[model samples]
Target chain A: MSVDPPVVHGHINGQVFSAAADATLLQVIRAAGLQVPTLCHLDGLTPVGACRLCLVAIEGHPKLEPACVTTVAEGMVVHTHTPELETYRRMAVELFFAEGNHVCAFCVANGSCELQDVAVEVGMDHSRFPYQYPQRHVDASHTQFSLDHHRCILCTRCVRVCDEIEGAHVWDVGYRGSACSIIAGLDQPWGEVAACTSCGKCVDVCPTGALFRKEDGTAEKHPHPERAAQLAEARHEHRWTNP
Target chain B: MATKPEPPAPHGLGDSLVERLHAVQQQHGYLPPEELQRLARAMARPLSEVMGVASFYHLFRLVPPGLHRCVVCRGTACFVRGSERLEASLRQRGVAFETASCVGACGQAPVLVLDGAVRSGDPGELPWL
Candidate 1:
């Protein structure tokens, strides 16, 4: 006989709720009808907590912890929204803008971009940090897709999806800070990587305009971020057809 | 005197793989594309993963090094003591060099490795000048 996982009681924003012991604070917050801005998080892929947008204040904790990775505990007090958290979240979103060339007007994922949505949620009117304006390039070597390094935020969503779900593992992060980028196999052109299955999973999961179909014009690319979660659920249930 | 401690190995890497990369670097003075592909095939790993590991570290050189290799230490101690002057001098002399985070010799501020010997002194008074 199988036993159910223990439920942990917690207080989110001073409201009491119960969740499975293994569930993360982010899951609990979402289930409580609360919202938290996130950039590097996806439903199906493993949570890397690379983006600091979802950091929340935990009682008795000196430092803020990422909600997506921090598991919920009994008597856990989580402040998803506070004045301090608001300041930090806004700053984090601003940094994302300053770090990359995110010109929403000319972006393929303009209207449908998560980064854009988070910026609005965080009320980021402008960035305080000076723009680096680093010279980045675009790779149109693939017949159907293209990668624009200028718009990439280094979230590693594409890298994780290709490796974890697709089993192709064609993408990997290369180099160090300030010089880091998502590289195809052996840092070669995307079209040259023999390991890639030509599946458009990476394009569908990208949260920004960094990866898009070659034929997509500005604001034309429509990503299906939910496909990853749906596919992961289907795979888990061993079901081949949509239920 | 306290005995020197062994440096910690790179994270998330197998000892044998690190050893193989070191051996290849020792033989070729750098990791060539063909050698990396061969190592990937031999190790039964993806080429991208191997390349990722190789490129992450500062010690591994993907391209060929210059005839005379000079490594200027850019660690906190050395940088505070003006390692940038040494780098500028090397650039002025048209000498090829690479910068390392630290060489474990903080006592000798503004240190540099000429060829293979560690030398520390005034940048202008150095032999490279």
Candidate 2:
């Protein structure tokens, strides 16, 4: 006897929808044609819930839950775009801008940056929180790519893509709190890390100007964020077509 | 063409990874790069993952320690008893010292470890002062 996967009925923004029992709230919300601002939630990659921008208010839950990691349940009432959620999402985007040196004018991913897009989506004109302006450095040691720590949001997209897809565990988060940054092979320079295959998957998946090609100047870099999902899907389906 | 010989495997340091790292740190006063690489290989984990865990904690020193080691406890109990003043004094004296969140000695508030010896007293009673 063939058994079908269980489907759960849920209400998103007061609209009823039926979704797979194991589907995440973000997936269900996206299927319902509702958009949720997310930075750390990338398709095909593991949902880490690092970014709180995708937080949605659920009935009976006191606190806003990250839609990327939250699973849909039967008879669940989810609100994706509430007034409080809008305020919070805008605040999160502003905090991201204030915490790091995201100078869009001189950035490589200025025209094609996810962080900038998210900021516009949330309508974050200015940040109320004081700008941190932490001292960060740029690592251009690699032959092809460069890493600007100032623009990095620590979304771990580069870390996950390199490890999960490329099968190269070259990148890892080092230090703690304010000192946290991505390190390559025991804090060595990117060029010095022998494990890196130089496949450029990390650079492709970077949401901001933090990782880009060395040859690219201001606003010249074009990141293909969908490459992760495409490559993951292709690998899973055993189809090696060009993305 | 001559094939390269495999490097000698590190001795089995037991199951606990952190304990093995602590043992290495204790022996070298810090975790050396070569030692960390060996430990990673022995544990069958990637070097980056091992380094990630080792570098996350403040206690794990990657660089060489100074000649005179001093650690001040900055826990709530210690902070309430003027550990900040003791730290300030140490800083003023140009003495390089590390800080621990808690040393599990709250009874002796404002505790300090001078070269691995735990002592709890007022800032004025410090030997450096």
Q: Candidate 1 overall Cα lDDT vs. reference? A: 0.87
Where is the poorest 10-residue window by lDDT in model 1 chain A? A234-243
**Which residue pairs show collisions in model 1?**
none
What TM-scores does chain A show, candidate by candidate in order?
0.97, 0.97
Candidate 2, residues A149-189, lDDT tens digits: the string is: 99999999988898788978799898889899999888888
Off by over 4 Å in 2: A1-3, A240-243, B1-15, B104-109
**Stretches of candidate 1 exceeding 4 Å from the true structure:** A239-243, B1-15, B75-81, B102-109, B120-123, B126-129
Q: lDDT per residue, candidate 1, A1-50, as tens digits?
A: 97888998979999999998878888999999999999999998888889
TM-score of each: 0.91, 0.91
- Quality of candidate 2 docking, DockQ: 0.27
